[model samples]
Each structure stands twice: as structure tokens, then as C-alpha cells.
Target: MSRPAQYHLLSLPDGSWETVSCLASVIRCRATTPTVIVDVSAVERLTIDALAVLVRKAMRLRSAGGELLLAGPGPAIRKVIERTGTGPLLPDFYDSAAALRALGDDGRAWQRVELSEGESALFCEPAQSPYCRHRP
Candidate 1:
């Protein structure tokens, strides 16, 4: 039989470009993991750019035989997900724990993604692009 899939848990701060870049690095490091559950409770609002990041990552993960999940989005964010027609692309759960349970945790200790300042890089688009406003 194949090996059991490993689950990696990460929490996003907000839907800013910074968060998107941070997520890009974090997910890159843990790309081999089968499941990535991102805690979005801290995100007050998910912007289109941020949503694009999630969708792109989710598609990449799915193609690699893995999955990405959004957990703990508020009502407004939920509406955004549904209205944007990304509900099916990105599976969301009530909370991280619920997501873990749905994936059959088996009590395994999962690794949590921590953001490092030095590794932040812009993954959205060319930083010089005038349309990308959230640059630092």
C-alpha cells in the first residue's frame, strides 16, 4: 500500500500581498505534503489578488496529488468564495480542527507553517507592474 499522506497546517494573517507571498514560500517548502490546511480566521477580508493566490496554489496542489483547504473564513469571506465561484476549487471547513477530522487525522502531530521575514518574495506578479499596489 502507499504511504499515509502527511498533513501540514498553516495560518494566514490577512488577504494582503504580504500574506500571499508568505503563503507562496510556506507552501513551496511543504509541497510534498498531501494536505495543507490554512487557517484563515485572522483574515478579515480576502481580496481578489489573495483569492487568486489560493486558487493557483490549490490547483497546483491538486495536480500534484495533494489538496489545499481554507478554514475559518467569516460570513463575508464565505460569500466571496461562493460568489467568485471558487467554493468547489477550494474546499473550506468550519475550522482547522474540523478539517483535520475530515481528513482522518489518526492523532498525528502536524507541522505548523511559520513565516520567516527573510524568505518573503512577491509571487503575485511583477513588482514593477503599476496595477500591483501592495508592494514593499
Candidate 2:
């Protein structure tokens, strides 16, 4: 089977400024594919520096022939993106399933994995067991 694309979850807590920069750098260094999925559901606020870092990282990913997909961005972050006129630079935005579908080769290969102990469901790459190292 083809390897699943790397997935990144960028949760923005109240003090995400420091965290976001570190995450962005990690993604830049570790990702082999140009495609990255940034999950921003946990973000409550975005600072200018954080936003700039995100934009720069996204651009760098694209220039390297990779794409960045954003998901779970809160209203605050959305507003920031709009106000800064950076929406165009953002890659496709979608909820979890949509994001996975967008990444799949056939657009029809994805599955939802129910978490153990009633945690939450995670989208899994088609034919791969959820939460497996190869499933991301």
C-alpha cells in the first residue's frame, strides 16, 4: 500500500504564539510531502506573529510542491485571516472528513475510526487501521 500522507494537528491554545512557531518548524523539517493538514480547532486567538509564521510556513510548503490544508479554525482565526487578506494564501479549508477526502488519491478513500473508551472518532486513510502509525 502507498504510505499515508503526514498529518499535523496544530491545536491553538490561549498561548499558542510560542507553540505555533515550534509546530510550524517541526512540520517544515519532518514532512516529506508538500501536503500538510493543520488542525486549528483548539485555537481561541491568533497573534500577528503566529499568523505570519503560519503564512510563511504555508508558502514554504507550497514552494516545495506541497500543499497545506486547514481545518477546525475558530471564528476568531477566520476573522484574522480575512482582515489580514491572507485567506487567499490558505489552502483548502474543510472539516475532518472533507480534509481527508481532499487528500485521498481517489477522493473516495477514507474511513472514520472510533476512538476507544468513547473519546472521539478520527478519520483514517482507506484500508488502513485507525491510529496505526501508517494510518495518518
Which candidate achieves the best lDDT against the true structure? 1
Best-matching candidate per TM-score: 1
C-alpha local distance difference test of each model? 0.71, 0.61
Candidate 2, residue 135: CA error in Å? 29
Estimate the overall C-alpha local distance difference test score of candidate 2.
Answer: 0.61
What digit string (tens of lDDT, one per residue) describes model 1 on residues 13-95? 88897677667656654344646898999988888888888988888677667688888988888999999999988888999
Q: Provide the TM-score for each candidate, comma-separated.
A: 0.73, 0.66
Task: For residues 21-40, write the lDDT of model 2, one tens digit per residue.
Answer: 76665554444455567777
Candidate 1: where are CA atoms >4 Å away? Answer: 1-3, 105-136
Q: How many angstroms is residue 44 displaced in model 1 relative to the true structure, after the best TM-score fit?
A: 0.7
Could you tell me how far off, in angstroms, the CA of residue 123 lies in candidate 1 after the best superposition? 14
